[model samples]
Target: MELARWTLETDPAWNEPRIAAQIKLLILDALGVAIAARDAESSVRVGELIDELGGNPRCTVIGRKDKTSLLSAILMNGTQVRALDFNDVQYFIKEGKLSVAGHCSDNMPVVLACAEYLGAPGSRTMEAIAMAYEMFGRLRTLMPFVSPWDGTSVSGLIAAAIYGRLAGFDLVTQANALAMGAMRCSTPSIVRWGKLSEVKNLANALIAQSAVQTAMLAGRGVTGPLEVLNDRGGLHQVFDPALDFERLWAPVSEPPFIMTSNIKPYACIGTAQAAVEAALNLHPRVKDRLGEITRIVVTMADLPMIRKQQAEIHRQYPRSREAADHSFTFLPAVAMAEGALGDHQYRDRRWEHEDIVRLIELTQMEVSEDLARRAPGAMPARIAVTLADGTVLTEECLFDSGHSFPDRGLSPDAVISKFTAITAPFIPQGRSQRIRAAVENFETTEIASLMALLQ
Candidate 1:
């Protein structure tokens, strides 16, 4: 019953039907995000690989043309889903800070891949998604006493559950899969601390890989330690210093839907949220005044954590993607000089423009207690542009366009358009349309039939 103590069975008020609906909606939303960001090289790499490895029709892998082996398909497609860190996120109330998000896409790819492997119907895909989300959410909610660890703690277990369900494993086998998956995948938090290596993008990929491996091992009747969650040397003791199991279980036991998920408009960390919005808003007005600014002050809610405040890594001049992604010092400075920030802005040599360097020289980010006291998902960044002639313009951004725009809260059409816009340049028009159509209407098609086209 330890598995029961850790998942859907633990929640007495659990609604199987509602959980299913939530999962279906989550997948749809996730696909929309993935499609929008598909053109990024990381995403393209995965998609192109899937397309080249055509196999028996089995599952719907987004942004690719062919059905591949389930394991390969999920690994590639799921990695694309998070290649840019621009997916939906849901947080648990227990820690108030420790949250879980698109790593669930790790579960989605594996689950859908299994659907292909079995030639299962959409109904089966839907059920697998629901169970995966519920089980994942439950594990995330249940473990608070462990930290210094990352969300992979929750992600791996959820992924394993998805893999097990798709592979026709029973409750015990599913539990074992989760145990082994977690054991293999858990890690320290430094992976995301400094620069924006492919590490953030690969976090979910690693967990998904572990999930698939665990499921395969379980299928062969392999058994792992069952006390993975409850053992004295288990996750909580090893990972989190301040553990609280009761509060973690309370929300899941009562089974309240933690649907307050936030979607990213910019592919960056939580700390950069407000600054990105502020720059996007002020860019239009300040474009003509690029050389006139005396000082650019970005007032954030809190002193950004260790990595974000690194002057040398980002402010001194970011040399790599990881540094650029986490550079609180660099993003606003670049936004000030260019009037906009896009995927190209991250890669282009334009980031080193003299004007941007000057802006970086002039820009300073300060912490405000009032701002920090505000709630999550409500990012508040204040930009005060002081001109050479002593004139000053100030703007505050509460939410970025894609995430907070009234009609733009991660809309499906918008996501589809984003996907097409980014990927069309790299893929053939016909292939792009085919992939988009399949992603948009996945429920109606056999996953394998759709996957076959990808190849």
Candidate 2:
């Protein structure tokens, strides 16, 4: 298969110093979210389940004292990383359309697990993650938003490739690994929309587990359709028939998708980040007159406005933390009223508060063609607050602060600040320092050493 040939010939490595540092930064950001989620409701429930399914305890559950089998640890760790929708995200915008999107860090736990299993060095783990992100971006160019296919559909394939490489699989076995896993990793996009659930947290984790198993099975001579990507009724036929299958084999981009992936500075989904930023920009000007505010108008990119602003019961409602992140309703309302957005806003069903609800009700969302043209890249948002005195205060955010493309990305110090902020409740100052240091000097550190700090 072409994928096998590419995997074998086009070797992966984090040789560039800048890319290496960025990879380490991504690791720190991922761990920040995963560690901070140690007490999240989903993490707690899943932690209980992981404890029940006790196995060899071969892998760390990450940011927790618990240990479980490799696969279980992947599930638990992945769930925790996504529990807060605070992990890093990668978006593929082809021809001004959002083709596919998801958290790049979703592949981190599985790679770390494989590295732990093989006693691999931190260098190998970094290269493996870089490869996974490259694959995610390449594969995403083919899986557009027009289909029901979710971003996790690429997770299993990426996970399989990582395992095959770490385990020293031959080219044939490696291709089979990807194909075998891809055939089984068809995830729907619904998990992330409309009253999101804990299932959203588990989607990528479960897909990674299956993908790892498929790769392992391939190592044992188990076979699957090698032509899964090109068969008469394959992925294109199943997802979007018009999908450009050739994008799957296109050369991986330089600097890779991991570098472009966003490091979220807020505790909300990517689509809402810019809107929240805009609202916060308008807060100081309108905070004192919040009660006098007649209506808050938020204009954003097309797709999200339609998907996140239509109706409350449909999905826009802040029914839960998951749904709240996707809601333009709760995000801007809180940001404007409080002048900040973070973990605390999601507590106590804050959206249910009378003032917040009234603010939410008074909020109106509209689509902007100019802004829509910039989406999946800049994610521009404009917030116009109308007052009782017939005055309109407006602010616009061209890009979310977390965005990392075309320069002006979050600085390492900014990333560190975010890490310290989110993880303060769970990780002590000394321990956080140690973790940060270990990640900074990741090339020489062992995979086990890094995981140890997380535990």
Candidate 3:
């Protein structure tokens, strides 16, 4: 669809304080929200990564006793935050939808590190984040993401945006860095083993690191193509021929333009968000009727046969974190088996339960147009439980937890509880509280202070 006339250049204005304030709130909220999840696997991975990369006690790695360099801390912490896919998500409500949970995390590490390393103020850090986040959305629209491109195409742009903002690059320099980064980083496609590995969670870190590297290069008088997006072999033409420049730029000049976002309730793939809710809703009712359940028919609208069918493989037998997120069958199966869905429940030996296996095999998935309409983030599902006696218990969830609907926002307390619960296992109660407090009070605090708390 064509978008109204709007371009970043046509309506560029510098509003440092308001935009900086906005970035600060988002940073704290995302950090706090991620810390509050209840994913042991995520906590453990984060903890280990922190210990592996030792640094000066200058930076605090939340949910850990060890401190690290600002860069390492952000990298380790950001990756861990998203490791379980339980971090906050930013997406659209209807018509157009794209996700930016990890990408923001990408900017967090880069921006925070830049702030601490250069002793930049909180406003600068915020500007870095806002710029990177904006670039992430814009570049994604104009490029192909996570395909066979081994190196990050958009990642470098995000990095450049973040770094350029902090290093005080003007629009011209920033544009050049963006263009050069795009040209240098573009490739055929990268293996999307993200569906099957922790490496997927690390995608943000890699992107962030690349962004920083590119920005540093630009700061040092390095130059790249200025017409990166509009050039002969520019990103727009080469990356995604279907890209709608008009639509992308329509609100390109508007304030408060960043509207797409979602906070996750479950630590699984975007597609599994609705399934978890459906399974959870069915749990209390199915408790006593577990044995009576002869067949479970799960109907998901919008998802393809592959996504729905792949779940059976992982549900029956999961291989890795990547597999777990993509599995439509396993999440609900484990939820039904363990009474709830959490990181451990999926990776725990309890997944070997015979009843769960039987349930997974017996559980069937079907697609509906209604489900497809919910694609990209809101994955809607309907679960019909057929008892041996012919009784059927059915539950459907189109608006699940952490979906970010204005009328259906997840409880803020629940958001905090989730962050504390996830980080508690790795961090002491006192440290967890401190981290929570820092995030809660992120606006007033200095960016350095925030970085100090994480180290």
Candidate 4:
């Protein structure tokens, strides 16, 4: 749990041009996703809650001119970023096992809030974000738990460290922040399973709020057991006993893990990215034979397929946007019908479209043992459309476009396009362009100036 000693020691990779560009792209992507989701039902509810629990204005909320408490700002901003589930992801081979460490941008709101509050430069914010990403990546690899909600816990740890560092806390205070944050970090698996709800999206926000409070407490001389991770009946005993401590404290490589993280191009769950791609690929062939198609079979890795099956409510009828986006059958069906899967596809009206619903009913999600075995490295999926004329057209997507797989990763221009497309709807075109330019030159800009433009 001595995270300060391990993270404060800077590595040269933190200053590498490639790593800096990757971090800027990730931050811009996160901001764009948050801005696009500013009006989302969940985000609106959270914003109202913040207004009701009004505190001294300390930091600016993204896409809003008003300011609020540091904790409230982090909660609202983090919720907005995750509202659409279109943020980035970090996957790695840890202890010889492939794992996803959740979305990297989950910790960015905390970093930005802290930096803006301190009047720090954007360069400093970027450095803090890089550190948080490294910490999250390392800890997630060490503790590969079953629940994806555990990523919220990892975000809490990273938030505490970032806030503590920005506040000029000592090593002991930083350690206490980690211990307190970890002690308070625990989420049930049900948040993401079965019928998804607003809680599924708010989980990270709740953790980010708690992390800011815990870090503040630590800065004010609050104390927590430093041996939180290694002690008996501590983090290891309470959750993820299989944690690989050696790997958790291991030295990182030159470019760091953020460079290897993925920026999602779709507005759905990460597991469904490849399936969506497959559906898009198959759309062209099935466009003319929509009425003639008898059934559509989707083959994916076992974990995702099982997740879709377990959400019985979504399978039968996805009544809410949250459930619809998480549904494997419904997502691909939307992609097949519309040739795309974006925020608009999850609207209540769109869900009622008979053709898409019929496509959902006709869809069959199957488990592919080969694909399941190749998971974490490749989220592969195959889609086959069987027409009434007995013609079966099929296509497979080994990796989603945004996935960081060798030459298959999304291009810089593609990332910028995604940012502009999502962000332009909420803000004016000129403002969107300014946001992009600020992020491009984030190294020289002040965090406050960049944040002011967000309003």
Q: Write the per-residue lDDT of candidate 3 for residues 90-136, one digit (tens) a residue.
A: 54322243322233454565666667666776544554555555555
lDDT of 2 by residue, 1-455 (tens): 77765654444434666678778888899899999888888898889998888988788988767668888888888888888889987666665655336788988889888888878787777777777877787777676556577778888788898888888789889988988988877888788665677799889988998889899899999888887777776676444536666656566656467778888888887767788988888888978888999988888776642444445464455777777777888899999999988878888888888988898888887878788676546567888888889998999887776878633344787689999998999879999999999999988988788898888
- Per-residue lDDT over 37-106 for candidate 4, one digit per residue giving the tens place of the 0 to 100 score: 9999889999999999999898989988989988899999999999998998766664454555578788
Who wins the lDDT comparison? 2
Considering lDDT, where higher is better, how would the candidates rank from best to worst?
A: 2, 4, 1, 3
- For model 4, how many clashes? 0
Query: How high is each candidate's TM-score?
Result: 0.79, 0.93, 0.79, 0.92
Provide backbone clash counts, one per model.
21, 0, 28, 0
Off by over 4 Å in 3: 1-29, 32-60, 63-71, 92-103, 144-153, 183-195, 232-238, 241-258, 303-317, 349-351, 371-377, 406-411, 428-430
Better of 2 and 4 by lDDT: 2
| Candidate number that wins on TM-score, 3 or 4 | 4
Candidate 2 off by > 4 Å:
8-14, 98-100, 238-242, 302-313, 372-376, 407-410
Cα distance off (Å), candidate 3, residue 235:
3.6
Pairs that collide, model 4: none
Q: How many angstroms is residue 410 displaced in model 1 relative to the true structure, after the best TM-score fit? A: 5.0
Give me the runs in candidate 4 sitting further than 4 Å from their true place. Answer: 94-99, 147-149, 237-242, 302-317, 369-376, 406-410
Clashing pairs in 2: none
Cα-lDDT of candidate 2 = 0.79
lDDT of 1 by residue, 142-215 (tens): 54533566566566666666666656677777677777876765756666654446666767776676667776
What lDDT score is found at residue 5 in candidate 2? 57
